[model samples]
Target: GAGVSQSPRYKVAKRGQDVALRCDPISGHVSLFWYQQALGQGPEFLTYFQNEAQLDKSGLPSDRFFAERPEGSVSTLKIQRTQQEDSAVYLCASSLALGGEMAGYTFGSGTRLTVV
Candidate 1:
């Protein structure tokens, strides 16, 4: 894919159900980031991975949320026991390298998750 790709563009989860979102970044990209965007708010960084190694996860809101990129290509974000407060869009972004080109990041269309 030419740009970052996310699956299930929209999802409606029943309260307490677990959900998994997928992100497929551009091929060979070294840096991948996951962010959460509440309605009408800017995206907030959730975690960062550089080539299969998770370098930062400080932005993850709670233990119930987990993200991983085991092969440095595809990543998955899993949220457990979905709650109404958790409803938001999950964004995935990728860059060619760490702090490369200064063009910032290429963000995917994002997966909008709704909890009811």
Candidate 2:
């Protein structure tokens, strides 16, 4: 794809339901990231992966949230037992550089998840 592509642009989940959001990054991009954005708030880092190795996931809100990039191309973020507080826009981004290297991130149109 020419740019980052995310699936299910909008999602509505009932409380306690699980949801998986997918992100297909640009070809050859080595860094993939996931973020959570609350209503009217800036995106907050959720996790980061370098290639197929997850480098940082300290920002994830809880154990209910998990992110992975198995082949270094496509990534999925799964949320289990979704809560009302979990309703937010999930953003995915990718870059060509490694950690500490300055590179512009290409972001996808986030998947907005609403829990009710």
Candidate 3:
């Protein structure tokens, strides 16, 4: 893909349901990141993967949130037992550099998950 692509641009999940969001990053991108963005706020880092290794997951809000990039190209973020407070826009980004900040990032439009 020419840019980062996210699936199910909008998602509605019932409370307690599990949801999985997918991201297809640009070819050859080595750094993949997941972020949670609440309404009226900037995106908050959730996790980061260098290649296929998950190097940083401390930013994830809770154990219910998990992210992985098994093949180093596509990634998935899964949320279990969704809650009202969990409703937010999930953003996926990819960068050519190991430290994403240095190379900037290409972000997907994001998946808007609304819990009800």
Candidate 4:
């Protein structure tokens, strides 16, 4: 089992540039979620998918932030027109399913996106 993994661990981008971060969830998991964490703040939900269907995205900060789980396992979060405010850690998590208390969500170390 790969747990959950994110690539680049860190990223530096110029303002207005676009960036894409990647995530790989644990095998057999049925739910995936993306979150953003600012310094000293808790993770804020960005979007979620059950299998290949995006079930929720209400927490996406803006239209520039987009996420997708194309094949129900690997996911990507793409930010268009990066801004300084977008500097933060992007986290990915997965669970057996998006039900109940979500107590089994496993999180990755995250990709730290820094926009300058």
- lDDT (Cα, tens digit) per residue for candidate 3, span 35-72: 99999999999999988999999999999998888888
- Please give the lDDT score for candidate 4: 0.92
Tell me each candidate's TM-score. Answer: 0.96, 0.95, 0.96, 0.94
lDDT of 2: 0.94
Misplaced by over 4 Å in model 2 are: 99-103
Write one digit per residue (lDDT tens) for candidate 4, span 1-116: 66899998999999999999999999989899999999999999999999999999999989998998889999999999999999999999989855625567999999998998
How many backbone clashes does every candidate have? 0, 0, 0, 0
Tell me the lDDT of model 1 at 42.
92
Q: How much lDDT does candidate 1 score?
A: 0.93
Kindly report the root-mean-square deviation of model 3 from the true structure over all alpha carbons: 1.1
Supply the global lDDT for candidate 3. 0.93
Candidate 4: count the clashes: 0
In model 1, where do residues sit more than 4 Å from their true spots? 100-102
Residue 115 in candidate 2 has what lDDT?
99
Assess the local accuracy of residue 67 in candidate 2 as a C-alpha lDDT between 0 and 100: 92
* lDDT: worst 10-residue window of model 4: 95-104
Q: Residues 24-103, candidate 2: write the lDDT tens digits.
A: 99999999999999999999999999999999999999999999898989999999999999999999999988653676
What's the lDDT for residue 36 in model 4? Answer: 94
